[model samples]
Target: MRITTETVAAAMKSALPNKTKYHFDDDLAGFGFYRTTTGTGTFFAEFRTVAGGSKKRLKLGRVGTLKANEAREAARKAIANAALGKDLAKSRAEGRAAATVARLLELYNERTRDKRKASTADGYDLIAKVNIVPHIGATKAAAVTRQEVQRMHGKVGKARGHYAANRAVAVLKAAYAWGGKHGHVPEGFNPASGVDRYREEPRERFLTDAEMIAIGDAMTEAETIGLAVDAGTAKHAPVGQRVVMSPYATAAVRLIMLTGARLREILHLRWDEVDLERGILRLPDSKTGKKLVYLPTAAIDIIKGLTPIGAFVIAGESAGTKREKPRADLKKPWAAILKRAGVSGIRIHDLRHTFASIGVGDQMGLPVIGALLGHSNAATTKRYAHAADEVQRRAVEAIGGKIAAALGGVK
Candidate 1:
């Protein structure tokens, strides 16, 4: 029956549990409602086709949010739009193409990674695939729920259990929700909702005095091997081979050790951001999004040998695009150096660990060390606690005994 005023009242009261009311008869073109977990609304279209008798049905709205007459009119409009050779569904796709879970990943790469930081964009890809697309990327956007979000959170929690893993999942949740919000998918999705946002427990990993010395020795040996091999490799180049390692990388590493700056801060450095005479390396912005850095003498000499031909401090690395160029990873040479120097289980980031460890070892004040590390929160700086302060005293007279002995039996 067509949804006339009388028919709508009857259909609204009708409990049609298991059948689809296919076509409209007479003035009743198309009309029916099926009870569902998602509330109720459907409209019928009685249309004639060349392939004999034909019928179609379309959803009206969630039962309570829309009135019966309102639904009837909306369905009529949808039918009219459909008749015009335009897809109402396709019109609302908002230009985002997510074919399979894999395709969503590809589109996400084009939209995010191509223009953003490599490290940042890689993170979006990793979690979106590992957590989301596998579970529900195929599910139509309208079908998501709070329970599914909880499952995703649990999955990330199970897989990594680290602060980073949970954090990655949160970012992925944000991205999916963002997709929905922008009409890439339907809105009102609770992708990041209903899951407990757990706090990361305290983690401290600064190396000890012995460990620091061992790693430094390893780094030195690695530099030796790198220098020995770099020349032979560079000579065979046909024409213009991009220089992989900067002359200042070693000294810069030393400066990272001495000053406790983040790896990216120095790695992304530019000549425009430096000041030789003022002995200051002024940053326009940092990971914190504020531009601030004070470079002491150690940072200057390390880069003094550098000719900043490109946009970065290690002098020649690329920035601003993901695929600009490839640079050498510190892995092999570092491993060779570490093996020769007899160090074990240390990463390049551990250099920062060593830096923090030294400050804690030197009897320096905790707040002072925190400032040197550029930490806004003392709690973050506190990771160096017990480890940062066990090494030295303020006055040189405290170590005069060693100096006296070095004076060749003058003592």
Candidate 2:
């Protein structure tokens, strides 16, 4: 029977239960309405591709939403397009294949898992979770415009500061590049490219001699009185209870100051990495790759005094019946030490700067200091050139005074 307003209305009202009924239009082939047992009806278009592909069914809309005349017109156009070599089914599939930003990030993470270090991978993942995913994760990779990325960069910079904003942009750039390379995004499309990165000055925070002494004294006092209770099982101490620092935490802090190593480099140091016979640390992997850290006698003494608890030098509290893993972080103990020393507005990394400052004051050249600090680039060592200039000034003054004295103090 022909599908018209009368027939469609009749079908909707009298369609049998637990059965589906199809009413084909005598006027147009493959244009029809199928009524389900529950009296719900939908108009659909069915056609084969010009290349003689299998028949495909495209749902136009529900009976109430689309009249029979509108459905027939849509079906006519669909059939015409199919005959003109357009594959509607394939087009729909390609639309689904356009990956979202979240999907691209996942692919990027998987691609770099083996190549990137655990810390580096964690940093990238954090940028995605904290910055990118929260804002534009659902947007299609190809649909993310450069203007959107620039706006996000600006917003993050205003809210969090330039450094964090630059980092977020860098992570997005890398992810988009990876997505493009892997065909997850459109070829030659990168929304993060060509955006200007904010200018960032190198930050150096060096500790003064008195500050170092105060910190040392505080750390000593902390170790002497601090408890090493198992955090997993121990009850919370009273509000006013005097808490002590962990021996491992104290040693780690001191080692960072003495050795000029990064916090992670010290915390992640293993027993196998220490060379007591040569008084050096042979790190197989570091930020600057393989490095040999020469230990001063004081630093060696600290290392010698530490009792190994697990694989790491700074081992965490043991889990029930299982060996403990490396300590995850030193936030609490570092805070306590800083508070006791009455020091504020300093980071653990500043201890490294302090070590460099001392070397500079001792008249060591920048090249030598750079080598000791495992700096891969001379440009990085150039930050200490001003300290060397101070030494040069003192040397020139002393020589000029001696010359004047030799000339019978003429001036």
Most lDDT-accurate candidate: 2
lDDT of each: 0.58, 0.82
Model 2 RMSD vs true structure: 16.5
**What are the per-residue Cα lDDT tens digits for candidate 2 across 99-167?**
788888877887888887877887788878877877788988779988888888888888878998899
The candidate 2 region of ten consecutive residues with least summed lDDT is 226-235
Model 1 deviation from native, Cα RMSD in Å: 11.4
Q: Compute the lDDT of residue 257 as modeled in candidate 1.
A: 73
The candidate that wins on TM-score is: 2
The C-alpha TM-scores of every prediction are 0.55, 0.69
